[model samples]
Target chain A: MTDPPDRRPGGRTARVRAQVLDAVRAELAEGGHEGLTVEGVATRAGVHRTTVYRRWRDVGGLLADLISAAGEIDWQPPDTGSLRGDLTALNEEILESLTVRPSFAVALMAASFHSEQAARAQTRLWEDRYAQCEVVVARAAGRGELPPGDTDARGLLIAATAPLYHASVLMRADPDPRLPARAAAAAVLAAAAGAFSAGGGTA
Target chain B: MTDPPDRRPGGRTARVRAQVLDAVRAELAEGGHEGLTVEGVATRAGVHRTTVYRRWRDVGGLLADLISAAGEIDWQPPDTGSLRGDLTALNEEILESLTVRPSFAVALMAASFHSEQAARAQTRLWEDRYAQCEVVVARAAGRGELPPGDTDARGLLIAATAPLYHASVLMRADPDPRLPARAAAAAVLAAAAGAFSAGGGTA
Candidate 1:
């Protein structure tokens, strides 16, 4: 088959980009945003300082690029047979990413708070992730798992996932082994009660 | 009536502490964590730099003390006669704090990510806030609004409030006017269905 025009070539440029990004993650994990220097990344990546300066310009640029790189990954929402199972799997993935020692995910989130470019990039990545995950809701609706009428898929999805972020990232709470499934089950029950229906009210 | 022994005196120390913390909030709102400094805060508070240095010692100290000061505020959760109404009021308060121009709440959260002292102080403040809000659940249970068994009040509260933070702080989504009430309604429904009951499962 002919090579796809949009496919990235496995060339030296790709290799350098991968190396530099890896170095960025390592430096961020070790020293956080305050200590992430372009020079440090260059030294770690074995690239010339001038090359790093010319390509990435500053720490903000490197951070923005790192987030953009994350969006290129071929990630998919879980395909568990039930809505609750799917949500549980999704939450498990989120928990694992947040709980890993010196987590690149947590470091990147902290770095975003310190950099405007990174914040904007992080927002884009979040929107993209939400959009991707909306498929889970759509599948549930098709399977007759959701309540009647138009469900606010985005609202349901956010409700399902936000607790994990709130607990792990904001509160720095010790992980409760049962929390992922418990939160998912709560969201599923709420959704099934038409709580997430468009134009739904507290009445 | 006599003054309580534990009550803080309205003395020079109290006045200075208030002014310095006010300056810290203003500085954080204007310039974020990167620009907050002891000298700048002292200048703004009209206090000597040495005094600030002696008291706070560093930016981390300033951040931690600022958070501690927040805990001293005489704030109370809303008692709106129903779980959904109370939760809606709580969410509105949170939304206002997160969305105000040059939001001090957002700035403090960002600063917490950058400083270990701030992070610990923030965690304490969060735990305190959650503990204070538990009364909302207790009131709901007393009114026969909750299910028949023990409820996981923390889980329920987190579900009700996490969507706002996930939206405004994490994804930077534009404020949805109805979200506060809607999220509360969803959480209330889940709680009524025993989704937040102790030892609950997806089954």
Candidate 2:
């Protein structure tokens, strides 16, 4: 039997989903997680309550869909053939997310505190982001950009920036927010590069 | 007619005060900020209710003294003659605290969240700690350890590590429990060193 064609949106359903999701994000940014309710969201979107409920089983479901879109933010690592350019790009992506969609991040983190499901969801999204960096690290290792055989350097690498991103959004302090991200990316890359050189030389 | 000499610790008043303060900390840590109670603390210390109440005034006063003592985890920036050494020391302090006096940090943060007085106290403590770091940075800068004149780098620095401390003790995910503190310090120091070098050339 032939596989069915993709049932991706082309019309009103697509438009409504876009509109509702946008409304939800705006509400989250403006009012935080507590402010997200079907009635409030429906009112904001100019959509019916039934339509909102029909689309999202609950607030959690709505958020999951919203978060699912986080994956769309660029996940590909840069190939500058040097750690500096590659890391700079990585930091920029993280900085962009922090500056633009910080509230969503804050809401998700706060929610993750209380909800195991939210934590699981956040973990997946973050791991995917880290996976992008891992690819870079792997390539950098091969290119003598990291300490030899530090296969799980991604954890340490991500650890470096995780605090910066978190503090920026929560404490409302970024201090050359751009500088922090860029510096973080650059430093990790350089350290890896140095490590790789040393390791390879020893080997 | 002279200032009274510093009393020896074996004195009745000093001994009693120490007992009350220890009781307060123990009780607070056992639960959280909300746990501190004059009656409970007095009972825990095996002290008379009137004596405890008269000394601390209220739970708030008792908590204040306890925090002031606990918060004084003095940091003398290591002068290992390199930024990396300074950062490692800082990160190690963070890690050691999480392991040794975990409850102290948790109680302080929780108190800040729960009470306005505690919040003000916590902020003061932070302001002081940040000032201490500033002195360390200045020393590094004077010795030409940091980039020349990267003066506006404090916010990112604090942002980078504050959340790591906040998360492990506050929101608390179990994956790589030590990562928040270690990562925050490493990331910030690494990034800061790199950023400084970019402007003034890495030393």
Cα RMSD to the true fold for all candidates: 4.7, 8.3
Instruction: Note the Cα lDDT for every prediction shown.
Output: 0.90, 0.60
In terms of docking quality, how is candidate 2 classified? incorrect
lDDT score of residue B183 within candidate 1: 91
lDDT of 2 by residue, B1-203 (tens): 23355577657677777788888877866865565788999998878899887877887677667766655756565666644456556655655565555357556654553444655665666666666766656666677755555643454345345435543543353435544444444444444445434442122
Predicted model with the maximum TM-score: 1
DockQ of 2: 0.16
Q: How would the docking of model 1 be graded?
A: medium
Chain B superposition TM-score per model: 0.93, 0.74
Could you estimate the TM-score for every candidate?
A: 0.94, 0.59
Q: B17-40, model 1: which lDDT tens digit per residue? A: 888998998898788878999999
Best by DockQ: 1
In candidate 2, what are the lDDT values of residues A1-203, reduced to their tens digit? Answer: 33345466756677778888898888888877666788888889988889889878677767777767676766576777865567666666656766675457667655553344655667677767666677676776688756666544554455445555544543345435455444555456436534223232111
